[model samples]
Target: MDGYTTALVCAAAAAGAALVRSGKRYIDNSAVELLAAPDGVRAMIEAHCPSLVAPARARLVPPPYLPTGMLQTIYGAMVALRRDSESDIEYDRQLRTMEDGGTVSLDWFPARPSGPECAQPIAIVMSGLGGSAYEYHIRCLAKHLATKSRAGMRVAVLNYRGSGRTPLTSSTMYNGYDTSDIYDTVGYLAQSFPRAPLVCVGFSMGANLLARYLGETGDKSRIAACVTVSCPFSGETAGRAINAPGLLFDKFFQPALTGTIKRIVKRNQDIIQSGAITYDIDAIMRAKRVCDVDNALTARAYGFKDCWEYYAACSSTDFIERIRCPFLAINALDDPIALPEGLPMDQIAKNPRAAIALVAHGGHIGFFSGLSARMWHLQPVLEFLDAVLADKAE
Candidate 1:
């Protein structure tokens, strides 16, 4: 079968994998509907904007699949190679560049045997939650964007404050719920690399911060173009999904954050004694259902009165309408993290400069489907970003 035919089959087979049992205790709350195709024929119509495909309202014009098992394996391997490249990231600390008295660090991307100039617009990507700049997934994306063939581009994997190899210096913590640090980091880059156009990409919670930053600052931001991949645009709807039963997401995520909070405090006895926080991190997660780990962590780390206040002020959905930057948002309906209903269609539509792309399935950044783990640039992303970069400011 041709490549096109192979993809259709994978999409159909994968559709069944996306459905979650409605009454099951685990992910009992999954809002998935497996769309059965008729013999899986190849066809295409119009597609929604990239941003719409990420959150709740994301939809793919054609379901994602492969024609045969042979194709699937081939596609899977190519992406897995890059995805696993996270193991190669090197962590380094900057002694003189300390922030808030904490050691600053970055997860360096491994350049090809030959070096490339960092002159082109570097992709500064932000990770979510207890996530590190060395996260396998984000590294996979960086590898794609910073290829030698595409050598003009470079990638900087940002760990915010506490999440990476560097120690958290200030009593304050980095949260997806806020964007001040992103602002500071971008400002530093703008000053350092004024000639290069900086493109910002954020995933999941990270995307929310990107959106919020653009909305709040409007055109004041120095970024030339932006991309938000699989961001939860609506707090209320995402909260419901986080609390969804079958996914076991809340169970898996909450405890990890809870433990990180403990570790963060345990490492600094003086901070705990200072009553710098309202409640213990574990206690907060136990008592209240947090929208995201950021919702809880930000409030505690920053001495906010409550998690609700922090989430509202920090999350981008509140300020999405205010964003005036040229931004692209990619969302998926099958995303376990960002539910379909969580997309802010009205707010996005209101922004004339924004575009949203909604795909049928890509398993929470697992858009792997091709010949034996080999991939085809994941479609629109490879093409769209290329087009975006093509129009350089002459």
Candidate 2:
């Protein structure tokens, strides 16, 4: 079959599989509940997904509108195909040099209503694995925040070491647990806008980095609030889930990761020939699974013994309780990559400052809700950040 025909067949197969497995149960919402919020805000959320709220706490009686688990998961990936590239959203690119001599790219989109003269709050967005400011979800959220004139929130996205157009200066690539880059980026932002409140919004792997950084820094962290969307709390479990049979998460991720690794190797081929860096370029290029890519490329680059060790060390679940800042974790029960089962819900419940919104439908970072593929999690996130900032002010 031709490439277009192959893509069509794959999409059809995914839709067929979703339909066949429509009734297959996934999330058990009996114990799962929304984070404690004011009755009014709780009512708003419950109006959309009643399953998210406890039966006794729900004020609105709207029927839950969550799509089937399989549909949610499939649409999460499918929406990417239909998404428009937000190329028109302007940004001022800045290269923040890291301590390790490497550099990360930061794209700053100033708020439409507030310019440099105003002390506007900055939202530092960390994109998912191999994602840049150009990715659909990242750009969508950035654009949404930009259009919110009253919010006075500037969007700055941190493109990890090797991703985007940023060249990989160092031999090491970013791992899930590493937060040094974020720390430096936040520090830079703080210096640039000393009075501006720093609110971090991280998606997927970026979420893991933010969570780990918060836990590691505690009260010492400069940021005012944090929101982790679709973070894989337990990397070990998430890795296993992505590798599961018939799941398309690995298929979607592996190619991009492999391509990045290939480019990195090619860029540093001179060092490899000189025996300065030891990387099995052939094995890395041949990697088929996410696990293999992590083991051969990520683990080796980051000084981890193996992929399992890397996953265990990088897992944010271990650091959840250590987080003392006001934090919100939003995870979809149907997320195919970040399995809901791996979330540290118990830890979150114990921390008074930490809250969780366990939505029944958003798959990974895919929370497309309407005909135009509007992100379902955007408003809730904005509301949560507003609440956090208001509490801080008071």
In the order shown, the candidates' Cα RMSDs to the true structure are 10.5, 9.4
Candidate 2 lands at a TM-score of: 0.79
- lDDT tens per residue, model 2, 229-310: 9999998988787766564445555565566667766776554335344777778778777788787767776678998888
- In model 1, the worst 10-residue window by lDDT is 36-45
lDDT for 62 (candidate 2): 13
Tell me the tens digit of each residue's lDDT in model 1 across 8-106: 988876775554332132222222222212221001101322322233422232213543222332233234334344234443323224444544444
TM-score of each model, in listed order: 0.69, 0.79
lDDT of 2 at 40: 32
Model 2 RMSD in Å is: 9.4
Of the candidates shown, which would achieve the greatest lDDT relative to the real structure? 2
Q: Candidate 1 has what TM-score?
A: 0.69
